[model samples]
Target: MKKKFKNLTFKDALFNIANYTVFFLFTLACIFPFYYIFINTISNNDAVQKGMINFIPVGINIRNYLALTSVNDLGVSFVVTVARTVLGTGLMVLASAFIGYLVTKEEMRNRKFWYRFLIITMYFNAGIMPVFLNLSMLGLTDNFMGYIIPSIIAPYNIILVKTYIESIPRELEESALIDGAGYFMVFRKIIWPLSKPILATIAIFGAVNHWNSFIDSLVYMQNAPKLYTLQHRLYVYLNEASNLKDIISSSPNAAAMALNSKVLKYTVTMVTLIPIFIVYPFMQRYFEKGIMLGAVKG
Candidate 1:
């Protein structure tokens, strides 16, 4: 059997065409930079340096990627970045979910005040020096904990989680309590599982932030090369001639091809972005749904 299409009016057809055209162009605009960078990274080093490689690759090879393996501290930096993203995202989601659950409880004393206190920090900035001094005083400076501790309690995430939990029927919690479940058990058995959408959304946010963070490492971990995240190392690799030269010299392919700084920078960027690219597609549905629903009630 043949399926029949509904007839469309001229205005409707025109509108649909315009909408599709606009979105197609917008998508292309978004994808082009990454595409351009990727082709440049794989294209011949001389052409890339001379800006000859544009829409497509020329004399493509994997030398730039192979060269990256030889960078000093690259392995350690990769480890640090992965560790930070995983630990930071997990702790942040848990803290947000727990605190979000707490604030939704009517019986928790001073809940409003505590919520306000947390939200207030989001609005205020104590200059960088003060924050640095505070971290130094607390022994977080030069420590991996510097990344995890400061980001664990994100107020914005808490608000989203709290709002999301509020949208859940109170009858669920009341029924659990009537069954003699304590608040913690009720939360663990009921609320936590239900909040998966928002939690996944927060995890995406936290992971991206942690993965891309370099300023914290730059400021606090300057003396601790062992603690450098991938982004910070990339920053150093781009800016420091000695570091770039040493890294290039260490890679036989990079040395033979004389890979320029531009190729190195683009390759490192794509490498850093690869994990997020792999992860986001799986989580995108939850992200869109959570953000919409989370925003609706609040």
Candidate 2:
């Protein structure tokens, strides 16, 4: 590596410097927002409120986080979000894998028609009011199942899984079947194991969607605050900070009133994002490989 660096021409050296500089700036840009928010949340309430906490913290404290713990309904919102994300991701992965595998079978009746039907839904959606009416008719409105049921079958995820499965050698599955293994057995023992890359890819997608989703809660749980997801609750909390301040000021919770609203907002934002930050790094290798391979063919 030292010898190669010494041998580089002026043009090559300049190109390498430019490439590294661009990537370094881009990475900094992506990371700066989170860092800025974090520093403000830790800064003293007076400094944060006076807008003096940029770039570095001043008189750092953790009161914002402590104050957030006292917010009403936060625990329930958190439980709902966690439950939604876990159940939604697991069920979607299973459904996508099962449907994806089924579409690859030539022996299945009307396979093309069914596959095309699924694909077409990707290009179109009924208007929001019609969807609301449909959900109402199905008795899904104001229900927790409303969050999971509508999202379990995603066409784009199915396509990724189906394309990845098709790339696998058919003989492996054929050999499993030759040993008297049924379709489910072959899937569990062979295909499922071999399709980890694409499955992980879809899992990441499902987890992120379910974690970040608030629209469903906003639309379906408007009258059911008990079923509200964390994102939706946070959305309400942030938007209502002005009105909330007056209420909190009169309350007996000194920690809640002492913390600046902006600081608390930043704290809550970090709370929501920390889980994704922790989980993404472990799955990134699979995510890159899976998306690339899945997109290459379809």
Estimated TM-score per prediction?
Answer: 0.93, 0.93
User: Which pairs clash (backbone N, Cα, C closer than 3 Å) in model 1?
Assistant: none
Indicate which candidate wins on lDDT.
1
TM for candidate 1 is 0.93
Candidate 1 weakest ten by summed lDDT: 1-10
State the lDDT at 207 in candidate 2: 95
Candidate 2 overall Cα lDDT vs. reference? 0.88
- List pairs with backbone clashes in candidate 2: none
For residues 106-218, what per-residue lDDT tens digits would candidate 2 score against the true structure?
A: 99999999999999999999977899889989989999999999999999999999999999999999998999999999889988999999999999999999999988899
